[model samples]
Target: MDTSGSLSITHLIFNASPLVQIVMLFLLGLSIASWTIIFSKSNSYKAARAKADEFEDKFWSGIDLNNLYQECIKKGQDLIGLEVIYSSGFKEFVRLINSGPADQEVVMDGTYRQMKVSQSREMENLESHLATLATIGSISPYIGLFGTVWGIMHAFIALAAVKNATLSMVAPPIAEALIATAMGLFAAIPAVMFYNRFVSKVEALENRYINFMDEFATILNRRLVRVRSEMNMKNNDVPQTNTQQPSSSYSQKSYNHPLGEEQHSPYSRARANTHSSPYQTPGVEGDRYRNTSRSPLQGQ
Candidate 1:
């Protein structure tokens, strides 16, 4: 018929020394902060994951740049990973078209650069709040230890001040001090879990970004090759077909050469420039993106 249970929180607090009470308050604040970070980070990571999946599907569906850009714009520019890629490329496209007449090389280069910039910016946004989690994870244990040490010191000081202290007078305060150590561990455990989780999430996202960039670059390169090959065929075939056509028609056709078709073909130049990927360059967004990846782009 023994119905005794562990002490209630109300009993513990009422009996706890002033120093123990202070340490408990500190632990409470830290616990609240850790939970807040956990909840917020959970939402952030979830959104990032969802957006990345949605964007990849759309991007690979062979939608035109304009269409992709329009969709992202409707969803707000902040819509995670893929939106950054689309926004950067589209912004550059607009800039190139706006900054007077430019060849295909210039336009493509600008677009590539912009895409890289956006990718980096998006990565930074994805990683922004993780640092807070990291801080809690790294420092919380030490903070808890400090509280424990303070509580223990207070217990010893109380024992010294008492003229004839028995086990009864000393044990309760010592036990209360141990609570601070336990509270510290409690705060620390979740922080460590979250930190590790976020680190893994960031790594997964980085890989996806890199893979998408490589594949997208390949697609663009293929388009460039096709354009250049068509242009070269037209130029080389000129003499072969000139005799069949009236001189005026042939000359008129040559004069109205499609902008990038004849000169500075996007194919070879892009291939040569493959020594450097847009992600490798130094810029605000570029730095942010590359730091997260930590792998140098090995151009083909």
Candidate 2:
């Protein structure tokens, strides 16, 4: 019963078998990595949520979309949350409108597609590191158990070799083996908890992005219809003057006195000067014009 050595934490770890020590070291590394990711991702999600809420407030507050779009552009790649979806959708809307006013459905389709693409990108960024966390949580306990079993096997073999088995001899090795399980639990709990939390937050963000995009598309569609209506009205208007221009010839000819193009203007005046007026009465002015301009075939 040689229990002279101290059973402090340092002693238990330092005296652990090589395999058990290796398992403990590996678990420590995993715990460090998981904690680092947890803090980093937690801060990232918190900031994302704040940005989304602020942007939604401004969007629904009736701020002009063009101004918002300009602000988003100024932010460049720093745009976050719903801003990313809005920026991408609105950018497509502007480009299509500038190219030429297209059908409402066509423009909306393009804008929505662009928004969906941006949503996918944001989801990818939001989901980062979640799989690693899941893997750590699911596999850590089994790895810890493996190290414990290996350590206990070594302990039992040593007991078999000693003729007199004692409590002190067995206690240190069993305690050393159990510490691996504790480390495994320590690494797993936070990773699993944070992984679920992050997933829920990401889902909330996705829903927000989709809803905002739909509302934005509707706004753009209404604008498209209103602008198209104005353009159609302008194109269909009847000009008040310049009826003699070549483009107006067909329209002007549609309503005539049966004389031709001259009946409308310059031609009408030339004909009146050369011919006797069929509408004349046999008064002094009419008789004089008839006597001077009667056809030569007529008797005087």
Best by TM-score: 2
Query: What does candidate 1's lDDT look like per residue over 182-296, in tens digits?
Result: 7878887898898787777777777777666755555554554554555455556667757776544223222221222333433323333444321222235333443453333
lDDT of 1 at 278: 19
Alpha carbon lDDT of each predicted model? 0.63, 0.71
> Where does candidate 1 have its weakest 10-residue lDDT segment?
249-258
Clash total of candidate 2: 1
TM-scores for candidates 1 onward, in order = 0.70, 0.76
Error of 1 at 15 (Å): 4.3
The alpha-carbon deviation from the true structure for residue 147 of candidate 1, after best TM-score superposition, in angstroms, is 2.1
On the 0 to 100 scale, the lDDT of residue 72 in model 2 is 91
Off by over 4 Å in 1: 1-8, 94-109, 235-300
